[model samples]
Target: MDIDGRKLKILEAIIRDYIETGDPVGSRTISKKYDLGVSSATIRNEMADLEELGLIVQPHTSAGRIPSDKGYRLYVDGMMQRTHIEPEIEEIILKMIKDRVNRIDTLVEETAKLIAMLTNCATIASTPSITQVRIKHLQLVPIDEHSVACVIVTDTNSVKNHIIPTPKAIDFNICNALTHILNESIKGSTLSQISLDKIRVSIEEKMKEYGTIAGSVLEAIDKTLHQEDMPDIYIRGANNILDFEEFNNKEKARELFKVLEEKPYLLQVLDHTPPNTITIRIGEENILTPMKDCSVVTTSYSIGEHTIGNIGIIGPTRMDYGQVVSVLEYVSHHITNMLREMNDS
Candidate 1:
């Protein structure tokens, strides 16, 4: 049977009480705390309907009911109100982004710390694939007559340097001219996006006399950008998992800690979380066995339209979805905005 208004109200009450108190919610508690205008017996009957529909469950033989995973999905989709981050908190995040613009790894770490602090849950932040990072700046400096240092900076502010050996002896003046040509051609292109042959053809056409020198530099840039290392993951507040009652058990805690440390599971979760969207994975929905009883809230961070990485919070199934979701949503968005500006500037 379709849930009536009264049943929906009762289900909402149960879920809210369970999340706040981390205890099974009895019908009497709902009748007393919520103005459902229903008596204890009536509330109990409605709760039974919810449980029978697999919306809630009783942990013990005679205890009050708690929302099932299905119940949480329903509430999150239909009942949870959208929320906004505080203006002061937004300001703080902006300052952090500005301070750490040149060091994206440090920024990711700091962001993970702030998220864990706000949500009081374990937080993991990862870096974007280097191959997808557009070149923000590239510089060539003559080390001597035979060698030049090629420094490439990506949109994420990660810097990679390669030493290039010129076919012919090159001086400072020659390096400056080539640097200008290279920068203009590759200002916003990633290493993977750059075609060595195409760049060589274009550069040689410009510096018709320096064909060999252009090839050497182009090859070095291609090699540098082709190395797509796994994303760097920074985890904070992992210990916070123990704070939840269900995860407090030593066996369960150890299992989860192992998963976090190994990170195979977290990466898998990141693969499923689409960019620019917040995903909530509840119990049993989590891919990792250790995370079966946990709920994860995740969102991706992007520069321009390219998603570089993701950040997430891990907690018990009875987590405060609204609280964690609001923080994740705003932080991810602000990070995207700031990084986009950083890339452009």
Candidate 2:
């Protein structure tokens, strides 16, 4: 059966109310709270139609109705129009993200935190793969006589620091010379291009005396490049998940937490989203069993040409679709722009 505009409005109101108050919505509440210009009896009839349509359900026969997965799906797919984020809130999000754009990992981490704060939902972020990222500059700073900090700057404006053991005699002057040699040899080359043999040959030819230091640097670079297994996954505001009534059951909440602790599960959740678009997976629609009761809103962010990483928010199925969609879309767009600027500068 086709739902009329009036019925749609009533369903939207119920979803919104349930999202805010975490309770079943009744016709009286809709009549009092929403200016639908309809009487409670009329709303009751419409809600009955909606419940029959399987859009909303009552936990108990005596209780009012709450949005079912079907209802939330309708809201997300058809009813949830793109809404503008308030200027003040947008600015705050952009400012927080801009401050961290100098480094890709930092930017991803901060984006997760900002999304969690703004959405009051659990947020997850994954760092971009550097395998294809070219080295912009390589600097070796002597930490002491026995250690050196290998600072690798990528063309995507990501900065990574790896500390390596070095000869006790190796000082700043020697490190400076090695830095020049390393930069000249590997600058503008992708991480894949800076192979161990290539680095070993280059370093040994130029500074054989500091071969141990060169080996250390090469090890750091290798570790950095082949870091596909550990893609800096970040989680923020996980505690917020408990704030929702859907997760109020201790066993259910513990199960969700246990699944979240598995990095592979989190990776799959974030990776499923395509770049430059938003995806909403409602309860039972989620591939992960533990997340079956939850809704995930995800959007991918890029640094340049590379579809670097994704940020996602996890909340109850009753999540405010319009608000979460707008926040994720805006933040993802801002991150792309800021990162592009970082590269250009």
Best by TM-score: 1
Predicted candidate 2 versus true structure: per-residue lDDT over 304-338, tens digit per residue: 66777888999989877788899998988988888
lDDT of 1 by residue, 1-345 (tens): 378999999999998899899989999899899998979999888888899999999999765998998999888888886567788987887788779867888899999998998888999988876776888788888888788898888779887788877778888788888888888888888656666787788878988989987887787767656664577888999988888898868998999898898766778867788879999999988878899899998999998778889999999988889989988888888788888787666
The TM-scores of all predictions, comma-separated, are 0.88, 0.81
Q: Could you tell me which 10 consecutive residues in candidate 1 have the lowest summed lDDT?
A: 220-229
- Each candidate's root-mean-square deviation in Å? 2.7, 3.6
Q: What is the lDDT of every predicted structure here?
A: 0.85, 0.85
Clashing pairs in 2: none
Worst 10 residues of 2 by lDDT: 221-230
TM-score of 1: 0.88
